[model samples]
Target: METTYFTKKDSIVRQIWGKADTILFIFAGAAAEFALNKAVDWLYYTGRLPKDPLGRLFSTVNYAKVIVFAEEKTAFQAIDQMNKIHAKIEENRGFKIPDWAYRDVLFMLIDYSIRAFEALERKLTLHEKEEVFQVFLKVGKGMKIADLPTNFKDWEIQRRSQLQDNFEYSDFTKDLFLQYKKHLGIIRYRLLLEAQILMAPKRIKELLNFRNQSILIAIIPFYRLSRIFKIDYILKELILPKDYKSDIKALDHSAAH
Candidate 1:
């Protein structure tokens, strides 16, 4: 019997999430925006995010990979599990996580998937962008998030509005950045900031006080050449924590399965 996947095999969503570098860039963008999000205190409630940011990143990546690469039944199980986890968090916190906050995260996944892929690879056609949006839209629906925009154009408008409305620099933002710096060390932390500059939206850049330019923009051509020569892993090794080296390598192979 043929197996059915949650994300179709030939889908652009698969292509976007299939590579380690793109996934890294996606989360790098997320890290910056997540810091500034008004809902970031929700993340702090568990104390896990601040204590083990990279571990949390890998856990998130694993879930995303399962949703992107696993069979339909398994993928839904992962989604349902995520919902249950959040429901429990809400139960403990004595209030629901805002519907808009749920939408904000779904939007982040959609937006960063495109941004990271384009920054690392090539530009996506408008249709491919729409494909990216649709895939995450399904995920949002599965999670029972309300008020999601129905199509790509609507999403663009909502996305812009959310970027404007949902973010503010707060004490959480300051402490999250400090945690990032602590876990990543000084040089790697700087590199994460540079990667964020490449993929973060204009508003995020301003909120983070990041300059408009990133050195990675100039270095990307060389990086692509390094990929061709199969030496990019060396640079990745230098940039990421040693504890996550195997997890990072596994990300490249996971999508192929």
Candidate 2:
């Protein structure tokens, strides 16, 4: 059998990020953070996000997917490029982006990887989960994000504490969310909110007034059934904007190799 780099090399990360559904779920969870975390407001403070929040977020997700899916050397170069971007942002702002905020984005990736995989596929073994964490840990270390935990277990503890300290709804948060709703339209926006509720930490959901039941809790079985009949493609096309169709379609496991 011919094995691509993903199947032969970083198979664990490939499997986690290969599926469109899994990547979309991960994006949804990150979207929740972008809307509610005050520390990340500088992302939108430049007014780029207000003009195109979905496009901005989709670009970030695409960058992440490319880094994970790229070959070893290329992946390192991608990380270096991202770090350079961060340096520029800090240089322009005259202050460093907080270490905690950097960690928040990393933790969000780790947390949502687990959440997305568990919900969309089988539960990951502890070692498999550690593999997921290790990939991002490597990237975080490469970017020189300070004070990342030594292991997945320690990271979980830090993740919980950081959530308590780092996030709050601010004016940026409110405006960004309204932009999301405007861009996604009403029905898709409602679905996005429902998915966020399902994927977010409890504190985040409560803060966002998502204390009510998530529609996704009732839709998972149906979602799985749709996959069997290939109805999920239609579902995705309806939910995602036309401009993003090609980008969303490009998120497959094959794309990783």
Give each model's whole-structure lDDT.
0.91, 0.81
The candidate scoring highest on lDDT is 1
Please give the TM-score that candidate 2 achieves against the real structure: 0.93
Please give the TM-score that candidate 1 achieves against the real structure: 0.98
Which candidate's TM-score is highest?
1
Candidate 1: give its CA RMSD in angstroms: 0.9
Per-candidate TM-score against the hidden true structure? 0.98, 0.93
Worst 10 residues of 2 by lDDT: 2-11
Q: Write the per-residue lDDT of candidate 1 for residues 115-204, one digit (tens) a residue.
A: 999998899999999999988888898999999998999999999999999999999999989999998899999999999998989999
Where does candidate 1 have its weakest 10-residue lDDT segment? 57-66
